[model samples]
Target chain A: MNNIILKVENISKQYRLGLVGTGTISHDLNRWWHRVRGKEDPFLKVGAVNDRSAATKENYVWALRDINFEVQQGEVLGIIGKNGAGKSTLLKILSKVTSPTTGEIKTKGRIASLLEVGTGFHPELTGKENIYLNGAILGMTKAEIKQKEQEIVEFSGCQMYIDTPVKRYSSGMRVRLAFAVAAFLEPDILVVDEVLAVGDAEFQKKAIGKMKDISRGDGRTVLFVSHDMGAIQSLCDRLIVLKNGYVDFSGDIPGGINHYLKISELGSSMNYANVATDFGIEKVTFLDKDRQEVNSVMVGQKLVIRVDYKNFDKRNLSLSIGFLDNFSNFKFACRSDVLDVTYKDNIGVAYMTIDKWPLSEGSYHYNLAVHESSVMLQNIKEAGSFRVEKGDFYGTGKLPGKRGSFYIEYQWE
Target chain B: MNTKHKDEWLYTISSKRKLIDFNFKEIWRYKDLLFLFVKRDIVTVYKQTVLGPLWYLIQPLFTSVIFTLVFNNLGNIGTGGVPPFLFNLAGITAWNYFKECLTKTSSTFTTNKGIFGKVYFPRVVMPLSITISNLLKFGIQLGIFLGFYCFYFFQGTEANMNQHMLLFPVYVLMMALLGLGLGMIISALTTKYRDLSILVGFAVQLLMYLSAVPYPISEAREKFPSKVALIVEYNPLTQITEGFRYMFLDTGTFTWFGFFYTLIISIALFLIGLVIFNRTEKSFIDTV
Candidate 1:
């Protein structure tokens, strides 16, 4: 018997951005006519991988372009991509929620998708009734559902309100019930998309555990998408990175995570106009000890984030430096110059330092700003962003001893 | 033993067909879901209404009474010897079923888009389930007609009802096919235009009058000789409804040619509707 359960070839999905009606009708009609005639859709011929970062003239752009991959039975594949990278579009095509503008997806057995928590849940129906309804919608038969019904209820921990309408349940309870039904579906292929992000911490751990059990114990193929790098790294045996609707990288999880982090940090085009107005920060510059502009710096090396500006109108200004990780979750923030610094004249330069930059060996972003006495300065939000290079924060190729953005070295007796 | 069986099962599952194209066996396996939807529609529709299921019977019965008065008594339309009440009731009942099926099926995508967008069931199942549940409602109304007929028969007041009434199932099926076909075409189109949805309610009413639900074709034939009556006679729904009266009431006409003509037309239209509907379901979400 063949072990390959799913084959996705050159699959791409394209979506028109504005009001769906009237605007795209002619384009849709032409596309449909071409499809019926068995010709390559004309729209796919335009656009390149580099076209993603900059907006282009073509009305139609591929959301997922020429994506070719296959998943054998029992493979747990993780998909990670920043916003607008077409990760959700890829899952939507594979799960058959929507058809691709071009390319083909071939899969054996039923495919169940948990695209969003409580996606098919009817608020008016009881939890139990919704289970049956949603289970059926996911392509499970009544007998198959009955066999796993008890296990689902127990797993969700919503047995007390199983007969209660889902509308009355709390948000956490709703996601639990939804996840329970989705994960227990036992389809030949399961496609999950950021569904666990809504639940509580305890439920999230349990959900990941159940996903592992599904892939390992049942030998079902799984495709998962999430922004949580740690979860993706732990759960997926293999990973696929989507950057602007194209498969940028597809391989082992560690390498995919590294590539994803780098792209996110480098992708944004910094705006200088918005940066100068905030935090008494008239100007922000990256410099070495020699006060020269430096484009790149090694990890753990002496670095400076210089904010030069005015103490206008005799107000107290506090300068703060914060570090953010690839997922945009803040790793650490600290404020210096807490004491009242009064300057009758308008200009001065304030420097902040990271002696050891304990950040894990990955690209990190630092935001430098001055708050008006504790409140962040105006325009500070727009003006601050700088990259930190990989240092020997945890030795070479080793995970930060702790599962967090940066390792904070502390002493014990 | 468990390991061996599990291994075999896993192998078989992976080896199953990919790119499933509307398998009937898979649909049959999800029969419970179909029943639940059928039950949900039946129960929820009348949940807060005062008259409840009585609305079903009262609607056609009252409409039939109105027709009998305006078309038969006032306008002097003939019933071919059957009482005007029974004559109008038969046509109105059958026509109502077809119209309801068409209306419900046409609005299938718009009404269930919320549900369909969230889940993956055979898209056809929803419209098919709606057609069947409506047939159940039709069955109840048909029962009311039978009661009226038995009352008139035992009382010896009504004229002869034709024995061809035994061919009732054929007419019922024809009505279903016509409704499904027309409904599917409208449903597929509505996903794109949506203007059709707003006009459908009134259109069904206007179509009722056009189908000769209130007056018999025999009477129309006497008044307007060849051309006008010929058009009404050939109306696909005309043959089915008039065929019902022809079978049960022993009245004006029953032509094998008319029945065959309608059966052929309805079947062809239904096949076309299915093809268009199948293609539309694939990409309707993008537009909708």
Candidate 2:
């Protein structure tokens, strides 16, 4: 069994919402007074859990609440969450860039966090100089950096401009150099937060490959935070999902991903209050052939996507609907003009039905657009979402399990 | 939290605060980073400027000229028997180094917030690097002053060169510590209050006059009333400038007791500043 190298016990971070200067002094005094009397901090009990969607009169909010986990040596741990879910706050605490309002962390060996690329790179410094500066900031010694200088430059692919100032490099070239320098950091544990989101696709692929080498080949612990579910699923052995500053789920990749998808789908129900626009989609719903609202349908079920819009202009409008997989990749699309369907009413309902839907067992999103010829009047991305469950399309007792996104009929001799 | 396996663990982070928890060993381990930061400060300042390093020479030279005219010619302040140009040059040379270190280090939190927010290392490394980089500039400016001192010496003018000159390094170290200590305190405070950021420049400017940079301490004692002269004599910088001129120019007073007094003060201030700095560094990112 692998050794547990990092342990986080009930870490929590609270932040005041307003100007910190004048407001913090009183809190500091309160803390000091409490310490003098040998009592617990008075303000720690007052803050509410972090939820950006809700309104509150309190000034304090908990950015992270009781986050606890352990990472074994050579284990790759992935953290996933929606925006404002306290993912960055947790990483910052583990990195020691900021202190938690409460709790402790115990780790074996050094931990290097690549929260952002080009963190300390000076624009006026040459590429060679920035490599040294950024490497040192990441906890590499001068001798260590000198030993790996050639490898870093070669990996960055900026060998020709090694002596040129970083200000002269393009944004892509800078990110490439930054990632290369960070990739060479040989720590016992590496904490990375969305730094792989920069650079071109090729460089991102190379960076992900390097991270794999860092954990598997070098046998080091890695804590990674990213919203790219595909990357997380492929890279992480275990996953942690955060919601409203709390750990929603922590387990295997597939289970955690499914739980996150279900939660987000439940949160984004067809509420017209959030989809108010001048001439756009007022609400979107997924229904079966019987016109009953549904969120999960069988693979061969007749799925109907209904879009209600208030078309302020009474002109004939064409509606285009697209189906996308869980990764937001377009799987298929249908346009009203292709089927000779038009809407002439000021307030209209457009529905597209796919008889015997061919999608496999997975979650998906649908996009809606209302247009007149080439001019787009309204467009809503990922307007509605649904899940396709396992079902037999061939009338046999067989159903597709963990296969690809869609299915097709075939006959073999 | 158990100490039984504490030896096995390599790193531990907690909410425990200590008053004088200065990690000297950790700082020694990161000496390479300190040197790299010092190098960056020196190399990048004049990278694209046309004057390059000559700007270092021009600033003090012009400031000394202005001091010579305004204080010597207009204000009738005497430089004992030494040439007024050399007197003002030496004062500006030593003062410039301290002022630069203080101003730069005082803004450490604000200027390096981006880097500090992203990574973790010894926060003290930033201010320590500023002191060292400014020390290099001080060395250059001291050479220029020596050049002028030699000319006046060879011309049979009263240029003091004595055995007291052996203590020059100690004097420079004291000045560096004083600047670094005050700068750290200001840097830590500004992360919360931010009013100190605006007051530091104006305060340093006013402090220069009280430090006897443009005139000798004796001149102020004789010209001003006793109560006013007592305030000038109390400033720690007065002893430094007076002792510095006493050694090189042989014109100002020098006392061993006063030198030790300033040394003790510098060390105390440095320790206190380090305590405050360590306390602030853990959470300054949030407030800043």
Candidate 3:
């Protein structure tokens, strides 16, 4: 018997670039005329690549371009990509929420998706009633939900309010209860699309832990899509990296993450607004102690950086700066939201300052991104690189004990 | 596993689907869901309202009263010796069933877009649930209708229940299927051309007047313009309403020709609706 539980072959989805309206009727009639005569769709032959940043000349764009992959039984596959890189489109097609414009998908057994939690839950219904309703919507039999209702309640920790209408429950409680019902589904193949992005950190951890158990212990095939690289690294056995509607990398998890990280390297050029959608960081400059632009800074001095950004919407953006090592490992990120940094104008400058930078002599690169509500609008890896030259420590003009990325000053007790 | 089941795939999803891709087996497997959706509809519809389930009876009662005032009293329309209240109630009862089923099932794609976009199930289940759920409402209204039926009977009226009343369930089934069939076609079309949604609202309202809901077909044929009367004569709803009134009140036109004509038309429309709905179900989410 074959172990492959799901097989996708040459799947692609094309979407009209603008509003779908009376204008499409003509094109639909044309397509129908061709189809009636046993000919291919006339419009399918021409479409632009899926790139939100670039301006499109054609009205049709392929959301997922000729996607093909397979999942083996019990293997957790991670799909990581930027917002419009066809991650959600591919998941939608796989779950049959929408069909591909071309090609097909072959599956071995039952496939269910947690595209959004509490999908069919009626807010007027009690929590207990919702369990049955949501469970049935997810393709679970009544007897199956009945058999595991107790465990689901216990897991959600909402047993006290199980009989209350969901309208009275908090949003967090709704998510917990909804996920509890879905967790007990135990389908042969589960396609999850970042549904864990909800709730607090603790519940997310518990949910991820439960998913790992489902795949590892029960041997179920899972296709997980998320932007949280930490969760992907911990939960997925294999990974697929999508870039602009194409499979950029598909293999071992570590290699795929590295490739994904390197995809945004060297975005240092000036003025991206012409091509970028919504918003993009136009320029990044590193300033020295004297407020002079420089490529390198001395260790033990302040790390001063200035980021120039532009937006079409003029909405306040949450800027993030992350430091990565040469091996593409993310060390730390400084988020503007953490420090109450915000800019409301369409074009504004953002400054990130780290007083008394503690580091040894080495080269390091930082990534820049503009975010709104955790959804990244623009992301640039290796936005700029800087070198740290040694500076006098303790006024002794002498080096620390050993040279490393981080330098620590200590005295023996 | 048997050798026959060795290479079997549970399902295959693609663009190349047959014209009538009805998944009877999938709908069967999700039978529990169908009933649960129906329960949700019945239970939640009256939640948080003051009148609650009473609203169902109030609507038909008020509509029949207005019909009595406007069409019966004002228009001087005769009911073939049957009381005007009973005459209009019978037509309204049957019309409401078809109207509710058609309107509810017609918006299946738009109303359930949130759930449909996130999950996969037999798309037919949602509309089928509407047809079934509306039956419960119809049943409750029938209680009120039966109350009126007994009130008029004991008080002595020309109308009397006969053997044709035995086909009551059959009539109800035909109306439900006809509404669902026509609604599914409108629903599938509305997924892309949303303007049809606006059109469907007034079309249904206009259709009620065109049918024999507020008046009898024999009277309309006698008084109405030839073209208008001809349209009313061929309408499937006119036949169903007329047959229902004939069965209960012992009035209106009823013939084997009209009965089979409606039966065949309803079944044909329903099968055609299923084909178009199946094709739209696959990709409606994109346009919707």
Off by over 4 Å in 3: A265-413, B1-7
Tens digit of per-residue lDDT, candidate 1, span A151-182: 99999999999998888999999999989988
Model 3 C-alpha lDDT per residue in residues B70-162, reported as the tens digit of each score: 998999998988899988999999999999999999999999899899999999999999999999899988889889989988998778877
TM-score of 2: 0.89
Error of 2 at A350 (Å): 11
Q: In candidate 1, what are the lDDT values of residues B1-288, reduced to their tens digit?
A: 122322233221111123334557766877877876776667567765899888889988998888888987899888878888988888988998898889999988888876666566767787777877888889988989888988888888655666786788878888988999889989999998888888888888877765767777776677766887788778888888888887778776778888899999999988877777766777677777
Question: How would you order the candidates by lDDT, starting with the best?
Answer: 2, 3, 1
DockQ (0 to 1) for model 2? 0.50
In TM-score terms, candidate 1 sits at: 0.84
DockQ of 1: 0.32
* Count of backbone collisions in candidate 1: 9
Instruction: Quote the positional error of residue B121 for candidate 1 in Å.
Output: 2.2
Worst 10 residues of 2 chain A by lDDT: A265-274
Off by over 4 Å in 1: A1-4, A15-57, A117-124, A164-174, A197-202, A228-234, A251-275, A282-300, A304-319, A324-347, A350-355, A369-413, B1-22, B159-162
Q: Go through the candidates in order and give each one's C-alpha lDDT.
A: 0.75, 0.86, 0.86
